[model samples]
Target: MDLASYAELAIELVNSSDPAEDSLRDLDSLQRLLRIRPHLGGRVTRRDLDAMRELRDSLRAVFTAAARGDHADAVDRLNTLLIQHPVQPQLSGHDGQCWHLHLTESGSVPDRYAAGAAMGLAVLISDRGVDRLGVCAAEGCGNVFFDTTVDRSRRHCSPQCAGRSNGIP
Candidate 1:
C-alpha cells in the first residue's frame, strides 16, 4: 500500500499555513482545506476546525520527533492517536475504479481525518523507517515533509523554499 502518500496528509495539514508565521484561523480556510482533502467527509463545524488545528499540531510533533532521531517519541504519539481514532478499514471503489482501502466508515470529520492520518503515519514509519519524516531546513520555514527522494537528501519542503534558501530571488 502507498502509505507514504497517506502519511503526507500530516505534512499537508501542518503546511496548510505557516506555523511560525501565518495560520488558517477561520472556517472558510478549513472548508477550503477539506475541499482539497475529500477523504475527510462529513459536515465541518467550528469546533471541528479547532480540533483539526490541535490535531495538526500533534501530527507535527510526530514529524519533529522523528526528524530529531527520537523515533520512540514519534511512535508513542502516533500510538496514542491511533488508539484514539481507530481505523475501520474497508474496501471502497467508484467510477469504474478498482476498490482500494478506506480508513474509517463513519465518524465525525476530525475523527475520520485523525484515524486515517494516524494509521497512514504508522504504516509509513514501519515500512519506510523513521528517517523518512523530515522538517524543512529553510530559514523561517519550519514545515514538515516526508523525505521520499531516492537519496533522501530533501532539505526543503518545497522547491520554492529551496530557491529562497539558496539565495534565489
Candidate 2:
C-alpha cells in the first residue's frame, strides 16, 4: 500500500484506548496489518517493540496535528523523525516486487519498522498533502485515523470504536 494507506492503518493500530482482555490481542492484530510487507520489518526483539511503541507515539502526534489542520506542524514532526533515522530507498528481492523502496538500512526490526512508517508518512505528506490525516470524533476517545474513505468522512479509528462511542450496544 501507499503512504496514505499505510498511514491510515498506522493510526488504527495505535489509537485504541481499550484495556480489556482482548486489547493486547487487538494490538497484535493491528501490528500484523502494519507489518504486512515484510520489508517493514516484523517483531523480532525488545528493542523492536520499543521502537514500534515510539513510532506509535510519533504517529499519534502526526495524526493529532493533522486533525487540527496543522500541516506545518505535522510535517515538522515527520522531518524530525526522519532526521533521527534517515531512510535510503534500496531495491532488493525479485518476486516481481520490483525494487520497492525501504525505509531503513539493514538493522534492527524496530529501526526498519520506524523507517518504513516514516517513509510512508513522507510519501503521504509529499503527494496527497497532510490534510488527509484525521482523528476520531468519538467523545472521550481521541484516537487518530487516516481519511482513506472515498467520501473522506472517516470519524472513528475503527468500526467497533465508532459503534461503542455512539452507544450502539
Candidate 3:
C-alpha cells in the first residue's frame, strides 16, 4: 500500500477524538471508520477495536512530539512503535493484473495499524521533513494533520477550524 495513505490514516486517527466524545466508541464507529479506510479493512473484533484505539493514542503521542519541533523525540517514539509493530512489505496483485506493494495484512488490529502508521510517518520524515507533521493551530483545538501541501501553508486541520478561529462566522 502507498505509504502516503498510511500517513493520512495517522493524522485522521489522531484527530478522530474531540473533547466532546470518543469517536471510536462502538463497533458501528469502527465499521464506519473501516468503510472509509479500505486499507484498514478486515473482520475486526472487539479486541481489534480496543487495539485500534491504543494505536490511535500512540499515534497521537507521535504527532504531539513532532508538532512541538522535537524531531528527535518524535523519532524516538516512532522507533519504539516500529520495534513493536514492524511492517512487512510485499508485492501483491489481483488476477495477475498490476503488481503493487502492500504491507502484511495479517496481524492484530493494533499491529497492522501501528505498522502502517509508523512506516508512513517514517516515509514522510525521510522524503519530506519532520516539519511535515503538525497539530492544528486553531486555539482550543488540537487536531493533527499531515502537511502535504507544497508550500506547507497548512495550519488548521480544516477550513472550518480556520473560519472559527478567524471569526469568519
- Per-candidate TM equals 0.91, 0.72, 0.88
Model 2 deviation from native, Cα RMSD in Å = 3.8
Off by over 4 Å in 1: 19-23
Compose the digit string of candidate 3's lDDT tens values, residues 1-169: 5776677777777887875766689878877776876666778789888888888888888888888889898889888988988888878786676888777567866677778888888888889888888889998899998888999888888899989888988
Clashing pairs in 2: none
lDDT of 2 by residue, 1-169 (tens): 4444444435544654445422224446446655656665455554555556677788788878878888889889888877776666665655777665444557666565566667777777787668778777887667676566777777886797789888996
Pairwise lDDT winner, candidates 1 and 2: 1
Q: List where candidate 3 sits over 4 angstroms from the true fold.
A: 19-21, 95-97
Stronger candidate by TM-score (2 vs 3): 3
lDDT score of model 3? 0.81
lDDT of 2 at 108: 68
Give the alpha carbon lDDT tens digit for every residue of 1-169 in model 1: 3455677677778887675444458877777777877777568888998899899989989989988999899889989999998888888885677888877778898888888788888887888788888999999888888887889898889899999999996
Q: What is candidate 2's CA lDDT for residue 52? A: 62
Which ranking of candidates, highest lDDT first?
1, 3, 2
